[model samples]
Target chain A: MKTIRLLTTLKLALFPLALQAQLELNATASFELSRGGDKSHYFYNEIHEGYSDWRFGLAQANLMAAWPFGGGWRLQGRLLLERKQGERPEQLRLPQLNLQWAPQESPLRFTLGRFLYPFGAFNGRQLPTERTFIARPLAYSYYVNISEKAGFFPGMGDEVKVPADGNTLWGSTMLYYGGYAAGMKLHWEIKARKAWLDAAVVNGAPNVRTGLPGSPNWGITSRFSVQPRHWWKQGFSLAYGTFMERADINAGLEKMKAYRQALIGTDYLIGFGYFELSGELIAATYRAPQHLPEEESFAGKALHLKALAGHGDIRYSLPFLGGAYLAYRFGMIHFGRIPGRTDRWDNGIKRHSLAAGYRINSFLLVQASVSTQQVNEKQWARRQQAFRLMLTAFY
Target chain B: MLRMAILMTTFLSFLYLGARQEAPAVIPGPHPAGVSAVRNNPEAEPVPLLRGDNEIYGLIGLPRPRKWVARGHAYNKDGSKVMHSDDPMAAPNRNVIVSLHPLDFQPPLSPTREAAITQKDQTFLPCVLPVTVGSTVYFLNEDQFVHSIYSLTLRNIAIGRRPPGEVHPRKINKPGVIQLTCDIHTHMRGVILSLETPYFTRADADGRYRIRGLPDGRYRMEVFHLDAGKRMVEVALSGGQALRQDIDYTKP
Candidate 1:
């Protein structure tokens, strides 16, 4: 309900852009089929049912429209609906409603309202038409040993159970997978249009993906990219903010700046005719509150948490064959340890993904991928695997 | 005798201008290979197709370049020949499309057939592909990445890949120039010309073009190239007279 209200408010804010100019509409719909999840395993979500059988459905639909409301103001909006395998029902989501003010002769652009604000380099192309694979990178989709509501607890005690159901608390991803965060962003082109810098301030921790802007904490994210040629690009990113909203179990929200999440990253892309290579490395640390599951109501001491994640991909377009390419990616995530013990705070994870993609033309694309996840913690499952096929059509 | 002489002179002058008036769409600008992806591949650009013995014939002239010629460049970091390529730019006079349309609204219906522009090696073959009006042009993908072919010049047409190798053919009924480009690869481009009249041809090595099968009538000729914009001239043929017209690049 809160998310719906937030989307409505965003719609009303950007609705004025629809009043002028010729509305240009674009749409892309996708269907997906996948297997390899169980009821107890932490699937795409930390605290959700991991449907145990082969399942398929309309994976996603995006209806997008743009209006140049003259005077250097243009509005772009997308209404999206996504479905997963199990319990979660399909709901309409307004992931983007950005109003940008860029003049004909200016090198700078200002974008306002809810958007997939650029905290990382990959956020720019989240749609199926733009993405290369059927599944998201584990850095974004894989659940980590951090919680949005209950924070983090190191090494479960005898009173705690694995896959705790009653608490509704588990590890969450560092960044909300595809959630659009409301913010005002400024973009500047420098170095003779060869480089670009983007900076934004959002409602809360970039890792928190809620559509609502109820968090008292504000986070700042920035990234700079340089393109020396058509086939090469490099980028660096940084983000910092108070991530925890509940002060009762966390720290004091407004005054305690130490209870925050800070992230740094670098990414690069190189396309050398027949093949392309790309990769990103991210490092994040958190000064988050930690408490025992049995110690119900206390603002426990802060725990220093750190993580490093990196992914590399290489794609090759076969010679003499049109619109057929094979890609392989390797990714890994490692967590920091507790202060007094040699044990780590969360599970160390790694994933391998391989895919084959073909662009039939501009209007349609198809990709099939197989992915495997491995956890290095004794308390968690050792290995999990999934296979997915996706079809995307654009009009 | 003086009146007869004056009538003869006037008659001769009218015939001179009328014979040369067959329109050519002459466009003059930087080579399209410098700006857009069209006609960039010179080493392997397929020659434009044409009819043999034709109706209208002429030599198309473009001003010799002075200094600035934008070219495709490839330089390896280590300056090694093992991983470097030197892509040549398309010649200006080649790939020029010249067509004749009847001044009267009734243009002779040209035979239409299925034509294809193949996408291979991340570049389009035959950068300039011409077909008759209402011809179905098939875009075949021969490279590894998904490539979409769309043109915004005459019709807003976009073809997606349903099958890996071939796409469903799209018929182009409109008579004009269409700029084809891949949505995935911005660097790959091609052009398709749909002609309403049956008489049209491309320029030869010496900047010449010819057309055939017209029935002694007023016609409009159009000439277009990536570098040359568009040029138009009105032509009047009478008593089945073969005409010679020259297109100039100096006239802009």
Candidate 2:
């Protein structure tokens, strides 16, 4: 068949290349079990199968390979396979691939291919051993709502819904350098994006006509950290982005406009031994054009502040353990939204968490913690408590 | 008597000249005299061997101990204690040590070609350890858990496990830090410091460490604490010299 000749030719082309080069492969597998609590209804929702009690799934199975060229040029690829309950069978996804030219003694490098967007600290620094907690920060989970009818009609419609997929594709370039005692350095990143939607919908109908022709967006972000000569340690960070979409119609209306957001934050650490204090404050705002009955308008501006302070327990590590025993953290968070904006609502939540952990060995660890959260308003607020145990090992 | 006195004078002159030459080098600069002398003599005589100096210096270099401890207790961080003691039948106040929790204590040191393995209360004793390359490390299981020792790096010896109260010695020829973990108890972990030189020591409870018997010279000294990696410090020693250094642990 014609397929046989194509396969034979493809193998011939790859055979010689494989024999002449060195290939390095690495893989990781993780399993996780979790349970969610419900206030208004049973824990089981439409998304759950017959089991409302507990769910177990394969969290990650990532495989990666890299091939080096003659002069600091290399090709790298990675494939991630994931499987969970209430989803399709095993699915394979390609997350990264690019031609990288990192010379031996050059501060500047280039990559031309599909690569991760170098936007913030989270996206750029993602190694299993580097993260502080088991799960990502809470800011990564905040959702957005989009009207499906508006998506379909382009200008006017009413079925508001949330998107399911959240990953965005983009190309980026970055520069960074730093070392100990000399203090921290700064980072500069620029990215060109080809997708419009980067977040999942919280509660809304499906929007089929999300991206139209000529709808391209790009973003630039920069961050810097400095160790000032002072009694306390200090750090500051800021990020800004804008997205534009071309006018398009799904049912009857034409949708056109640009969306933007800005964020700034700072943190400080002071004291030592049994009593130490650390806190961070952040403020963020988003700007977007909304379609009204007679004319288009812009609304929906929000801000949030979070802070935490804690003391350590060094009783157990006193004479010989050579390690600290326990530490308790208490924190509060407040959310505010502009009046007349239906996009987001704020009730100002207060949270308190007490965590205790032990390092069993250099590469192994065990920890147990309990947290309680309370909100101000009864109707809009919910009180919850959680206990968690975790184990992690790395090289 | 005259001949004897003449010969004695000649010997005395030779000794005086030698003493003058051995006087520490004094570079006409702002540099410390000891530091300069050490730099001038790279292959000078080694320090005289001393006995019964059981006291070792300990140093712990950490930016914020409270923060790290809290994070560790909450299971957000990693590292274990260097000592533990809590058993009904165990010796009173006898401390049990563990190593190999963090990426530290590389190139472990052994008293002999054979290293000691401590097992107590279902845990590996001395969680972090360093050993000279090509030496044999014995794993004596004192706990109930059946423990297995394996390293991802290439080692001259094969990987296997030993049962409780049993001793298993495996030769490690390769020079590199190898992580040891137990298959039965996933949480059981340790480090094997396979080093090229036999002149390394683990920091004590206070994070103080000393490597003796170094010849007179200027050495690029490096210290690796749990929170800090190999921090470099320049040190100089003279013939039969004793040097003291203090390293501050800081977070990166």
Candidate 3:
């Protein structure tokens, strides 16, 4: 709350500069209503009142600004506020704060401070106004059975079995849910930006949002993409580094650095004549536990425990409206098996999402969506499915 | 009230001319702040469509056809478009402006004319525009969003924030390529081809064009395309004869 107040004060102080055109300012406000399905997800996009009752979730607002200096330099920041049920209800987030130097007609650009980890092709389009759907990609939102503090829980004894979903200690994403990390990033580009190479060194790996103190854990991420044609693009990315929290490192573990996360991903995008299709596939592995409970660590027989995830979505613009579109996405995340277990480490989850959105103007958008988790078909049938209605406004 | 009356009059006149399937009467004058042309100069009178019989008629044929597929122009059974677009690819060589420049003949400077570029559907309508050096152009926001229309080349014409249903005007005095863009929508782009030449007209969907009322003279015919840039060809018109020139981009 103090941070939020400070950010508000900072914005108030900068209003005079914004009015003078020295600062480009914009904001996005969103309200969401959801019903059915599990409501315990982190970020609480699926919060619901009852099985038969619709529930209101959030009144989220993001204040964004940029200060463009002469000679192609800029400072960017975002302050996010949301009223909802979550780990930090009603708490604001300062996710995007960065300084960039991109000289005009230059092939290379540099950025520092806290910024979006340049990992996936879609990382840059995290704002609701820029995307077409209400439900985020499951690959980016789903938390695995890995404890952010104690590490992966699969192939372990009952003492360290992974807790339920939404546990603060165990909730982690393949991409840290697009977290803005303290980092430095750079990109080299050419051919009207048809091709580029982006690389970043951040505080921690993308899967776990934890970092060791004193720079003991640093993640290096890189991506290379090319658009050989106006309608097609392809890229590949890789991230690797020691990512365990200091707590896990101090837990009598051997070779703590070996318990890192390494991920490899490839993505493609196709857009032409009002139709857009994009997809990415990523596979990551948390190096095997060097030392743990004899029964929990499979007697030191467990190899690298792996997770494979991907998502594909397509959007078709509706010609009748200024910016109306319908989109469908399918995503899945499946885990590798333990050394002695007859089943995979975790349930292989699949989700199918359908959404329709209309941009009333440049500043406002309305979206309605529904999604079903196929892996929990039986359990989730209690709520039937999840439906979401959202309104997003920008100024 | 006078400004409002002029706006209403202009709107009514535009409707009247549009109803008749004829182009509106464009009386251009020099911008008062700069340029050499006077508004009432005798030489700046509206040229007849056909003073004599001297004219240039031709088609601009592209060397190769674009590799574009037919987009959605039909509707689905569900009342939605089959595809998201209402375009079937642009007509060949569209938006290219053709003008004739005389080597030794200095035509009278142009006076200002009221013209407009409407902001609609996240784009600047008439993406390509041809204007005189001193014409007054208005940027109108027809969409339901505010647009910050600006041109780095015409930096003096400052239109900070143009809300919907509002119109902002600027008198362009310099002669050069003025590219306009919206700060809100980076994909939206427009170009104002400000030429000093008096005889200028854009090509039609069929890549065909016609320019009339050229006095007997030696001239340089300039073909301008957004992608192919500008090219010059020399020609002479005498005896009020009609000249035919076909510009083929495939050839040198």
lDDT measured at residue B38 in model 3 versus the true structure, 0 to 100: 19
Q: What is the Å distance of residue B224 in model 2 from its true position?
A: 22
The deviation in Å at residue B174 for candidate 2 is 20
- Rank list by TM-score: 1, 3, 2
After superposing the true interface residues, what Cα RMSD does each candidate give? 19.1, 21.9, 20.1
lDDT tens digits, residues A1-395, model 1? 99999999977876664444555567788877766645224434221345535766677888776656566776677788876323343877787787878866677778888776676656765777666667666667766656655566653321243243354444566777774678888887776437888888887676876645676678899889987665577999998877665634444223354567888999987764345678889898988766555556334467788988888887655322345567778778888887777988766777767888776664677888887667775444433567778888876
The DockQ values of the predictions, listed in order, are: 0.03, 0.02, 0.02
The list of candidate 3 runs beyond 4 A from truth reads A1-21, A38-53, A57-59, A83-89, A154-168, A210-216, A248-250, A288-303, A376-384, B1-252
Off by over 4 Å in 1: A1-20, A37-49, A84-86, A154-167, A247-258, A378-382, B1-252
Which regions in candidate 2 have their CA more than 4 angstroms from the true location? A1-24, A40-52, A68-70, A81-93, A112-120, A124-128, A144-215, A227-238, A243-257, A266-282, A291-334, A339-350, A353-370, A375-395, B1-252
Q: In angstroms, give how far residue A270 of model 2 lies from its true place.
A: 8.7
Summarize candidate 2's per-residue lDDT along A1-395 as a digit string, tens digits: 88999999977876665555565454545444433333211111111223234555554455656665435555666565644222432866555555566565444345544344332334322333333233322232111222222211111211222221242111000111000001011222212111111221111001111222233433333334333322244445454443324333222233332344445555554422222344455454444344332333222322221221111111111111222123344344444443444423333334444544544545544444454455555542442444444554533
Predictions in order: chain A TM-score: 0.86, 0.55, 0.83
Order the candidates by DockQ, highest first: 1, 3, 2
Query: Worst lDDT window (10 residues) for model 3 chain A?
Result: A43-52
Show the colliding residue pairs in model 3.
Answer: B28-B111, B28-B112, B29-B111, B29-B112, B30-B111
